[model samples]
Target: MENLSTIERILAAKQSLPGALLPILHDIQDALGYIPPDAVPSIARALNLSRAEVHGVITYYHYFRQTPPGRHVVRVCRAEACQSVGCEALATHVQSALACEFHATSADGDLTLEAVYCLGHCAVGPNIQIDETTLHARMTPEKFDRLLAELRSKP
Candidate 1:
């Protein structure tokens, strides 16, 4: 299958590195968009790690997704700093607007919502990182709607 071949290629490419598990996993996710459950066994075998070990690593990191992401990813800060600035309400608004919870892709597959501890913009708490860039500061329900509208309008 395509997934198997991609996983094999990733394993071969990164197996030679020191502390290769993390890099391999990251590469796998990067290449496939998500680390499919089936890839776990292959990864474990290539690295001589147990399935449990591989699964543990995947689940341990909030960034590693087992399912593919949507066209866009929205990460709302959940750290104490963001919380103090009303991130809780912001998060609720995001989930309600997207109709998806943290780590879930929207039904239309246009967006994925996730909860991140911080985006390094704590001073501007309630910030969100859209995709890999485009950090929105001082987020509120109204601003979030505009952002979502822009994302939806994108190709």
Candidate 2:
């Protein structure tokens, strides 16, 4: 399959690097949106690690996803800083609004909502990241809906 070919290429390309597991996983995730379970054997063989090791690495990191993501990814900060600023309320709103919970895609598969520990913008707190690019701070339910509307409007 094409996924195997791509995975083989990535394994061949990065297998020689020092401390290659994390980078290899990152590259695969970047290219495929999520790491295919079938690719684990090839990756483990290339890295000279067991499938358990490979799977462990993937599971250890919050950033790694085992399945395909939705068209859009929405990450809301949940660190203590964000919590102080009412991020819990914001998170509740998001889950209710999208009818999706953290680490799960919406029913229509339009969006994925996740909880990120921190966005490094803790001073502002209550921050949200859209598709890992745009960052919004001091968010509220109203602002979230407006942003969601805008995203839905786009093709």
Most lDDT-accurate candidate: 2
Residues 58-125 of candidate 2: C-alpha lDDT, one tens digit per residue? 99999999999999999999999999999999999999999988989999999999999999999997
Report, for every candidate in turn, its global Cα lDDT versus the true structure: 0.91, 0.93
Cα deviation of 123 in candidate 1 (Å)? 1.0
The deviation in Å at residue 35 for candidate 2 is 0.5
Which candidate comes out best when scored by TM-score?
2
Residue 142 alpha-carbon offset, candidate 2, angstroms: 0.7
Clash counts per candidate, in order, are 0, 0
Clash pairs, model 1 backbone:
none
True-structure Cα RMSD, model 1: 1.4
Off by over 4 Å in 2: none
Per residue, candidate 1 scores C-alpha lDDT tens digits across 1-155 of 99899999988999989899999988888888889999999989998999999999999987899988999889999999999999999899999999988888999999999888878888988899988778889999999999899989989
